[model samples]
Target: MLCVTDRMKLIHTKGTQGIRGHTILFVVIGLLITETSTQAANSTDEELLNLKLRLNTWKNRYRVLCNKYSELAANSSAPVINCTGCPDGWFQVGDQCFLLTRDVRVDWQASKKKCAEIGSHLAILTSKEQHEALENERMRTRVAYTDFWIGLTDVENEGDWKWVDNSMLKTPFWNTLKSEPDNNQSGGEEGEDCAVVDSKSQSWYDVPCSFLYHRVCQMDAIPLQ
Candidate 1:
């Protein structure tokens, strides 16, 4: 039979092992809880990101629909061309109104006057975006392979170009390949001082202001109240 001291020792050892097992079990449970919390946080972050993307898409769609509605409303008023956004025949792009004419061909001066009569001016392309828009319009209308007048000229001073709005022409969009703005006279007393959109390249070229051609007009788009 075992002694009393031996029995006490055995009980103590078993008790220690039981305490160790419980400690290990508690550690594993804690680790599992931490892992679950981290996974839940990551899932929440992904969901939030998805929501933001969807919101942006919906906003863009709403803007397009609003513009379409505005266009339809403008068309409803037939006789009176009171365009609150863009006129019936005009295109609205980036807060501006553009009108491309194919039928009316006239000199640069006459074209400018006509645009003024319609409460607009010859188009002054200040950026590549405007230039691309004009190009697209030209293609859409399928204007003849001929020059079209724009609002740019070096009339005041030689080699010093300016727009009809008195804005100085900073970025030159002339066709370099053709060596444009050559100020060619083509057997005329007045050398080329006006700007024209070359039919071939859709780039600006200096031509005589007296030359007759179709013109593009632009004005600010009236915002809806």
Candidate 2:
């Protein structure tokens, strides 16, 4: 596992299933290094093209990490690395920030609290563009919601489902060919307020705010220099 950290004092958290996650990253890095070191050996254009692509990807990943590191390190003693790559837990969402927390189900309020405890917030889809970005990042098919929690609800009004961030939910989307819970039936009834982005193919689903969901959290990405 690559357990490099800025401060030796900072305890090593279990970094990304490192032994496994890093296998792919390291293989790619090694390929580029070997290719560059052996450049005079007459490499194939195919190998060179692959190297260029991989290097470009790493550079882009580094840029994203640098931005994130900047924000988290600001106004603190937090030191930043020149380029070790993106933090283990996070995945990139276009220029946004994302982390795959797996299937941890928690109630709306509790989920939000947990996200903060981890230095983040429950996933907040503030716009259609962001929603599209998230789908692309996750490939939208592998994960499950079991009705996961999202940053939206009518804590203010009974029927009005708005994003917790107060961002407009202008884009209508849903799973199971259903738009949303009408809030009329009484199975997992009232006060159960929270939203779930379902189908991994459509917009998302908003049920009672109280239903526990396999949730994901998102945080503000560090700004680019």
Candidate 3:
């Protein structure tokens, strides 16, 4: 069995193969180095404060990655470099794992929290492939819910959407026909700050964060040797 330190080292030495693979190295290195530097006695107050802020960012990344690692590992596949597939109950699309909830409806924030409770977060679709994969998955599953909460939201500043990872929204697939994400005031007092994918139309639309809906949770699929 590979130890945590050894696994970290192995990841560094081999490096992740793709764009997202390097994410672990970047976050882990920043987290470890910033943590060490923060302990230095000669650091200025401003420097310490900056380090703490960066550390917090890195820590968030670490938490997201760690959640994926734990979930994938929990599936009990024989330890190997190449991953066989996503764990039970999670379907794989590219290098990520996703879970579509059923018989459970909750508000956007509650859905996000529930995903975290299970070591995941609301789905963040960054690519057309991911979007199509999820659409097909929804069709195949035949769920009753048409709208499912995703990770995209403009809660921090309405109309300026971002994912759970704080990344700016790119390659969006909003339902243009509906003129969605208008932050429609009719939705609620705070307006529609959260996004949900319409399973039938295969498009996303902004909705009130307080509205109850099913959710699609996602996490990275990290394979360990």
Candidate 4:
């Protein structure tokens, strides 16, 4: 009876030892699985963080581009302004300046257009003073070769000689022999009823206005101050 009881006790001790080893192994496996899962989760989080950082970088670049576009768009629209320069040589008229070129060979109308382009009119001898001014200019320049054009024409009515500026010829300064036209006398061999200044001799001439010649234009020096 004593031998049987010792054997049974040994069996129970062995079974308990085997059960404890199995429990320890199961605990180690559980710990390894938990560590692997945690490591995967940490890696996924790091990858997500990097992706978010990249997205933010792209967003910043987009914002910068938008700002630059807005600035350029704002600056594109503006108004153009007009500016004028002083005309070449003559003297200042009322509000413009003038320049009389050395006598050029152009027709009467061409001469007038040339002067107008430079912001003035042909030498409109409006007053005796203005006529004297022309005579003086001719004397000073010593350009007395032939007749030159002045601001005079009879475009509308025959015999009604008028300044190219359309002002009436109230004053007279005939060179002794010739005079204003006797009739409208539409342009004939005399071109048009235009004026010319004989640059060499400094005498005025009533040539056909259509004849081409060099002429003068006037400008306003400053505002009529």
Estimate every model's Cα lDDT from 0 to 1: 0.82, 0.64, 0.83, 0.62
Query: Listing every candidate in turn, what is its Cα RMSD in Å to the true structure after a full C-alpha superposition?
Result: 16.9, 21.3, 26.6, 32.3
123, model 4: CA deviation in Å? 1.7
Against the true structure, candidate 4 reaches a TM-score of 0.47
Residue 179 of model 1: what lDDT? Answer: 92
Pairing residues by index, what is the TM-score of model 2?
A: 0.53
Show the lowest summed lDDT stretch of 10 residues, model 2.
Answer: 7-16
Q: What is the lDDT of residue 76 in candidate 2?
A: 82
Candidate 2 total steric clashes: 7
The most accurate candidate by TM-score is 3
Q: What are the per-model numbers of colliding residue pairs?
A: 0, 7, 0, 37
Per residue, candidate 1 scores C-alpha lDDT tens digits across 1-225 of 989999999999999999999999999999999999999999999999999999778766766767677667777963333334677778777779988887667998999999999999998877777777777776776765557788898889989999999989888889998898898878287899899876456689888888888888899997544
**lDDT string, candidate 4, 85-169, tens digits:** 3433465433344455775578777877887776677776544545445556657766554455677776566557788767788
Q: Residue-wise lDDT of candidate 3 within 74-184, one digit each (tens)?
A: 787835233434667788886789998985799998998999998999999877777777777877888656788999999998779999999999888899998887899
Better of 1 and 3 by TM-score: 3
Deviation from native of the Cα of residue 38 in model 1, angstroms: 72
- Model 1, residue 27: C-alpha shift (Å): 99
